[model samples]
Target: MTSKTIASSEPSIIESIDQLFLRFIVGKNKIYKEEEYNDGLSEAEQDDKELGLPAAEEKSGWNQRILLEVEKDRVKRVEADKRLKDKRNALLMRYFQQSLLKVVNDKLENSESVISDQLQLRENTVELLKKLLAGEPRYSVLASLLELNPGTRNRLLSLVSSEDFMKALGRDPRNVRDIQTAIGMIGTDVLRFLVPAILFKYRINAYSHHNTLFAKKLWRYEMTLGQTCTALMHDINYRRPYEGMLLSAMVNFAYVASYQQYLSSFEVVRTACLDQAREKGEKNRHDFFYDIKTDSASLQALLVSQADLKLSLALSEKLFQKSFPHLVNALKEEVEGLAYEERTTVGKILFKAVRFAKYDQLRSSRLFKPEWQDDYLADSYIEQDVFKNLLRQELFRFKPTWS
Candidate 1:
């Protein structure tokens, strides 16, 4: 009875349901149309136009607002990517530092004592002599004569007893004192040849037995450079091939020693990297391993001095003095006052040889070749065709002996 006359603003139940459905449809259509309109305008323009702004103002505001937001988002994304890259690089550097420290610490802990060091030195010398004498009939005969036989009274007696030994030494046993004197003289002369060969072999062994990857890389580089240098000197008819060989071998050995010293200062290196990152920014941080500033002259001096001393101790004083009378003096003069031209020549040859060897190693090992940037060697040296053929010959002969 209360609803007998329906008000204009109110409706019956069925009419109310139909009105609700119609409103729902109308709302959905309006939303769809608004979406279509919004698709044609920028977000800023859509909002401004919906709020009843003029078309010109909407267009102008749209460009500025949208561009600002896009620029802000782009900046944020770039910063995020940079942070991610820096974090990854830092982690990688930390891992390398840790690994290097472990290697250096292990080497230090297991370093041999003085007596053991002497024994190892003697053993290396003996092994080098054996290798030097292994394949040659004449050298083998001389080596046999040099060996002490308990069956005989001494080395002299052993040599006198053997016909081949005396023959190789170009001595007659008819005069025992003369034979002894001749053997002494021959031994002294032979030592000149033997010493350099022995030192070279020792260097090769030292490089081969290194426990680290970087050491191993240095070893390969040394081998390639030494061989190439020696061959180049020979090809150029250099009067001092032995000097060239000794110098090349010493350069690499000294570098390795210096690098080891650097590695021993791993804590300093890590701190330096951190400081560099903080001060110069992460992108400008120094690569500690590759960026080590080795004093070439100092390294050369140290190596040459040690070599002179060691060779004197290892060989008979008379033999060493007679054979290498000016070795120390010559080395001192060359290393101390090395001319720019001379340094450039040697450095260039070595650089080219090392580069070639690196590429060869990479190709042979099926490893990825990184972009070969100009490193320390390149900084100090320029490539030339001075020893191109010689380098090729040496590389051809110098097969990879490393695992």
Candidate 2:
């Protein structure tokens, strides 16, 4: 595809906002590939792909690494500021409610210029002081207190929503609500939360070919866990229609991928596993997977005797090895000395549960009518490709990852 020239006269703010808008529109899956969004494609060039142009080229490894570093540094600063949330909120309140905080206002006004200098407020401090004197509610008032312009606010919020930032905060991104709440709070602070919220949404829960949830939300979420995984494995989604088999397999791999990072309190994988076990009438997932330190032969014997329980354990191990071999090695070190039979059983069960969670491409049962068969066969290759292409496109962006 030919590259379009960005208008040189365009204001930097507009250019940045356009760039941010393009990133949001693409909804690039960062969990699979982090550098795809930072390639600096012009908005129009990206939009042209909607007209059937080829996808944009991948950025160089050096550029990708540099982009990742910049993102990391910005996230680090945002996280460091998070520890002082009470202080930041207080500062924000004081920055907008000087009339209510006369003592604070006086102190800030009389304080050394170096204090303002240290915070980089400089001349903005006077405007902030004036806004505070107007006496507005903190959250509502702060929404209008644009210390940074819209573009800068958006960029900063994106940094706040980065993977590194979430990791530093010890935030687990299992539930949509938790991710939404965190991003919402940060974004509502007159610092443009939309981009940050979108970024967080992508990270906490991405679509995958195997997630029933992902299949459910195909259109709304856009990128399947499979697509994300493929992007990570293949570097980008540049391959043509007939060349998607590798991408399909990568999607499958991501479905069973293991989690090694420190997850927050609200991950759904644990809950989903427990729910599946309960539905299947299995007693004690912990007993099936966990190794008891106490010398309890009876507990060990009971674990071995149960057929379904043993199967579940075996499934879990096999699936973990497939999805995340790296994680399996780490996990093995943590729970050593489990009986071979017990391990096999647990891996089997876990694999079955994960398999059932896969996305279903064909939502409706197959139509077996003679007329339907004739209609399907009459379509030309281009028409068939277009129909299948549209279906995949719609499926990729659906909501809740499943329905």
The numbered model that scores best in TM-score is: 1
lDDT of 1: 0.40
| Tens digits of lDDT, candidate 1, 112-212 | 32212321324434443344333233544444543432221143444455576456556655335333353454453344332443344433344522234
Computed on alpha carbons, the lDDT of every model, listed in order, comes to 0.40, 0.31
Candidate number with greatest lDDT: 1
Instruction: Give the RMSD in angstroms, all C-alphas superposed, for model 1.
Output: 30.2
User: Which digits, one per residue and each the tens of the lDDT, describe model 2 over residues 1-403?
Assistant: 0012366654333223223322332332322222444433554465455433333353444343334688667756765664465365445334323322232223223223312321222343324323432233354444344333343335444545566544544543322323234444443322221222232233323453223233233223223333322222232232221112122222222111111011211123344445665778766443331321111122122222221222222333443345334334323421342322444422222221111112222222121222333233222111344334434544343121111
Candidate 1: which pairs clash? none
lDDT at position 36, candidate 2: 47
List the candidates' TM-scores in order: 0.33, 0.16
